[model samples]
Target chain A: MIRIENLSKSFTLHNQSGVVIPVMAGAHLAVQPGECVALTGQSGSGKSTLMRMIYGNYLAAGGSIMVGDVDVAKASPREIIRLRRETLGYVSQFLRVVPRVPTRTVVAEPLLALGIPSDQAHARAEHLLEQLNIPQRLWSLSPTTFSGGEQQRVNIARGFAHDYPALLLDEPTASLDAKNREVVLSLIEAAKARGAAIVGIFHDEAARDRVCDRTVDVTGFTPQRAA
Target chain B: MTQDQPLLSVRDLAKMYGGRIGCTDVSFDLWPGEVLGIVGESGSGKSTLLGCLSGQLAADRGQILYRGRDTRQMSEPERRLLSRTEWAFVHQNPRDGLRMGVSAGGNVGERLMAVGARHYGDIRETATDWLGRVEISAERIDDRPRQFSGGMQQRLQIARNLVTSPKLVFMDEPTGGLDVSVQARLLDLLRGLVRDMGLSVIIVTHDLAVARLLADRLMVMKDGHVIEHGLTDQVLDDPQAAYTQLLVSSVLQV
Candidate 1:
């Protein structure tokens, strides 16, 4: 289970002479295991910010994010690393692969981090990449040269590679083609069936309708900046 | 053991010091999170084999593939980056692994710095955290490794190597030169950290007990060749090769 309460995050832009911008304020949500919650919002409504906070990528100004027994907001770096390894999995809008590393390795890394045998990790990565329709020829090449749709597939493969307790997906199917989007939708269904609690931003309404059991509007939680 | 692409693949890897064979025709695949223990008498090419695998010593023949790329073909800078970030080598002597001149915190912080962690506070916090993880006292963070006891120095060395959260670590006699009690404690600490981090490790040890404690799989070497290899329990229990049988029975008699 995942819980978020009174989540507020503000970024003080130094370039704008220390102008403090509030992204999210007083947001509250709870998601049960096996539930898929879609975060719906217009551009700049703090959906991504909320998700990042849940994943502990961004420090919340004030709030609590509970994933299972661990409070992500207050967890130590070691605790966060453990959560990432065994409990929580995240897929952001962009795929960050090490330069010159092969696509197969990028996908296999998470499983390797969990101490899964390399053979098993690579095999699982291959299976996921195959399901995502990544070409066999591209497996050994770096995804840095790949198209946006192709890279999104790689990101999805890496994200779904682990069977985590909680998963955060930020625009998972955004740049993907219809075929790839359907594949992602099915993957989400499988994850849900496996009892994974998922929080996602699905711009594709059909994708949201297919995977999300409930919707949380970020617009309601976001505060408009003062002039 | 499993039919999956290896994280590290070595084919007919050989290194020689003049006419003497350091290691010959050493071919194997290391799987992720799997600890491959290379055990043999001193000069049986255990250190030589590790040197070749770690890119510290160049191979005289054959290919070493890391993540499916030939490591021998990789540029020096690329190999250095891999060593500094993805791979770690823990030397038999703590002095070889740690900088005696630097503070314990700085030793651990150096690896983070190499990887581009510019925030001093974050680096110091991480260094302190790792020091604690490796059973070093928080108070000794400012003390140099030269000022520490042998066991503490070794623990600090391990902390330094692991601070980067490397996927693979190569340990050469990590428990060597320590008192029996200290060795036992260090082994326990190492076992816990290894399990928690899910790190893939290749450990070279002459101590059979060390192999039994740390290794998932055993690779027995003799005269610069791998005489036998199997799961730790199976090899230690059944003893397939004659040399391995001798090795196992010798430990039992002690």
Candidate 2:
């Protein structure tokens, strides 16, 4: 469902004396629908930068990223935003719940962002939460009270609730214990079974082994390394 | 069961806020050059115990003794300096353990700088040495944490803590965000470092397997207290506490 060719990213760096040094270089990746791929590499291997390119968080310096016929690399800002909203989903390594937002509201925020009516959005979110077995008692409560595992579940619920055709998750199972990790993995599998194209950046080896059909080694893919 | 003064000691430690509980009647003495793994479910108060031991939070009751010195009796600045120079904590989120926007070198050297190391070249050299030891390339020294991978960021966190060579180290799920292979590598690195340095460590984790791998002794906590504590093999091989049994069985492969 997605195609990327010759994708490259770089940033200019400044030295101790304020001299600029350019870092990052041409990187490439391609992900298919109904498939899970694991990106493995050491730090500064450009794994995250590659994900950012696909997620449209960073503008690629060169090459093309096409998702279902839309050229994400060349798409206008509005077009990219729409594509991100309607066609793609992302779960960050850090759970990015807007502090102070209720769990129910955080779950429903995307639906509202998609311009669904408030009532309809709330109903959809509530229904999904019920299906996911989120307790009704905590529906209006902020996610801060929930533990890391609970917060991860909420993150998964939000990412998949929208039913986007393609999903991109960056290390979704990092915070979970073994049991909860299994649950989240099963959920991801269920999403794939429902025909959602999924690409995940993973750190947990067990999670990666369970969810991914293929692995892409990031070593030698880039020159970035922690000093 | 009291022996010669332990490096750190906790007795009947209880912390409660309002109706909420942190830990209850928690007691443990950490000996020199031993690794203690604290295992628990989320909200099991493992983190709170770490906070109490590190003096990040004052115990509502009970005494924390560091080499016979009552931590509660120490003045704020005294405790602060002790916590800074003699003890180190590695939090779950590397971001919490580090200044995210700072360069890797800066993150690794900050502790030294705080302890009054003023030579930029000396700090940079030390940072480089630690990074290399942690398997991080020196080229990325100037890059911000944002530019590193999750595993790299975690290693940077470790480098930062270990560079100070603190007598006692507290790690809360150091590999919580790493992949299996990376976790293995990091665990190996940590094990080796602890052995070579004879560093005392308390690692809090929910992963019983992880506990088995690194800890000489294991303590399983549920709710707010340690339900079981023993040698790692004894605890995992024959858990006396039902909670520990459940936890051990849950993570073991059939």
Candidate 3:
């Protein structure tokens, strides 16, 4: 299970003459295991920021984010690494991998980080990459050279490589074609079947309908100052 | 040679340092735009195999054919020209790949100059463009590599090696010395560039994560011998070799 309570985060822009920008304030949400929650909001409504906060990429100014028993907001860097390794998974809009690395390795990385053996990790990554329909020929090339759709598939594969307890997905299917989108939807179903808690941002209503069990409107939790 | 022939081929290649073996009976074929990874623990001879294949170290026996020509038969100047114009090597350390005293733009521009690129303005413009492509700001073009962070230096080194648009690249642990976040970002940038340019690459690393992510095919080496070779997925998912299985399981236990 994952829970966020009175979560507030703001960024001070030093480049903009030290002006403070409130991203999220007093936002509260809970995602139970086996449930998928979609974050809905307009552009700049802090949907991505909220996701990053949950992933411990952004520090919250106040409040709490609890994933399983660890409070993400208060967790140390080491604790966060362990949580990411064993429990939390994230699929960002863009795929990040070492230069000159092949797709199979990129997909298998998260598992390897969790101390999964190379062969097993490779097997899982290969399955996910195949599921996403990334061509075997392109698997040896760098994702940097991949098309937007292909890169997203690699990103999705990395995220789903492990059976994480909690997952955060940012537009997992944004660049995907219909066939690939269907694959992602099925993967999400499988994750939920295993009782993983999920929070995602889905601009496509059809995709949202397919996987999201509920919706949370970010605008409702917008910081008062920003509002 | 047929049009479908491999871009590079190695057969029964062997190397030795005095009485000690470096690598023996290695063989493989690399298609254009394909990425092949060689993996093993330290002293496993993966590095020696890479050195022999890249022509940095001479092989004691067997053959290496590049674009249908035997590399051993090529003149010294011819080999130098090939290294400068058609091939690139990315070292594990950024310092090895980059010239710290020179400006970033100069580092990239020099590669172009080596390949007979003239027109000073054109060189500078291309350097700046490559910097941007590698996710480095153009504003840092004049800064020396010493002034850059480790991640930035690695990115700059990539931009330098890639500015000439070499058809083949060899990388040795390109991400071995960086924070996790920085490594991820660098990998992303590298992937995009290789894909965009349709480069053929050979990479050496002990880190299976890197092999899994980048190599199309993989060769597993142990004690100067090739233990396993197959599609990256096959070698990793269902390794047939006992050594490879142990390597896979040991990484997991770590």
Candidate 4:
């Protein structure tokens, strides 16, 4: 389960006369096990900010963001890294490729981190890549030079390779073809069925309706409106 | 030791040389099977940090806890025993770590002997196996390191250090003196060995590409200060510090 209470954030511009920009305020949300909540908002409404705060990517100004019992906002970097390795998974839109690392290794890295045998991990990664429609020939090659769609597929494969208890997916279906989109939707459905608590940003209305259990409009948490 | 505790825990570690800062207030935990790369320019004190951690140089301040035991607090002989058994260091120059006058087999077998392998045949077989693993042939085992190429000597040095299966390895610019192709081959061999053996490594390198290839986490040093430390890919790709950004950007494309 994931929980957030009294969450707020602000950005300070150190340069240009030291301006402070309050982004979100008094945000509260809770997600149960096996539930998928989609964040809905226009640009700049703090949807990504909220997700990043939950994942401990953005340090929250105030509030507790809990994935299970540990508060991500208060956790040390070591705790956060451990939490990411074991309990939580994030699938961003982009694949940050380390040049010369094979695509199979990249996709299998999550499972490998969990101490699964490399051969078994690679097998699961290959399965996910196949399901995501990446070519077999590309498995041995690195994903750095791949096309946008190919890289996205590789990212998805890496994300779903491990059965993480909680997940934050940023545009999981973005830049996918129709067939791949269908595959991604089914992956989300499968994750939900397997009791994963998910927070996702889906711009596609149909996909949101199909996979997300409910929608939380981040517009309600904007700092100016809250003030 | 607790199951979740870090393999190596360093707190407020610092070393200085006559009012000149070597590395100051460097703190981090190296988890089991993790590779932590210390990267900076020529005088950044990355090598200084390595020397202090590997027990080759004594630190002026702070504590280094290896598996719940403070290394600095240990007696000299105990620390030496730990160094010979559970710890290994690979130098940038192979001559620094390898006994150039000794045969390649003898260089590796000496580590086994240090760890109490009295049987000659067994030590020789293990030395030969390790030599082959590092891609040096059996025939070269009897030859002195002076007869080997730079890369072969480096490989022989790796065989010497790893023959004991040290729990933690300290490598300072392990590929610094090698050509590009040789460096690539050595990196590949190291990667495979690291994964297969689950070795915990503290590697200090000026090469970002080397850090990118080998390290799980990275600490970017500047003027003896740790300016940035994070996951290697995160630090490299989305570098927050201006110094780290410059360091990453300055890598040549060719």
Best of the candidates, lDDT: 4
Better structure of 2 and 4 per TM-score: 4
Q: Which stretches of candidate 1 lie over 4 Å from their true place?
A: A1-227, B1-4, B252-254
- A108: Cα error in model 1, Å: 27
Better of 1 and 2 by lDDT: 1
lDDT of 1 by residue, A14-45 (tens): 34455677778899999999999999888878
Residues A118-209 of candidate 2 have per-residue lDDT tens digits of 78888988876776567899888877678776777787778866888888888887777776666678878987887777777787887888
lDDT of 4 by residue, A1-55 (tens): 9999999888654343545678999998999989999999999899988887887
CA lDDT scores, all candidates in order: 0.85, 0.78, 0.86, 0.89
| Model 3: residues with Cα > 4 Å off, grouped in runs | A1-227, B1-3
The TM-score measured for candidate 2 stands at 0.52
Worst 10 residues of 1 chain A by lDDT: A11-20
Those runs of model 2 whose alpha carbons end farther than 4 Å from true positions after fitting are: A1-227, B1-4, B252-254
Span of 10 residues, lowest total lDDT, candidate 2 chain A: A12-21
Top-DockQ candidate index? 4
Q: Deviation in angstroms for B163 in model 1? A: 0.8
* Order by lDDT, highest first: 4, 3, 1, 2
| Number of the candidate with higher lDDT, 2 or 3 | 3
Provide interface RMSD per model, one decimal.
25.3, 26.1, 19.8, 4.7
Worst 10 residues of 4 chain A by lDDT: A11-20
> Which docking class does model 4 fall in?
incorrect
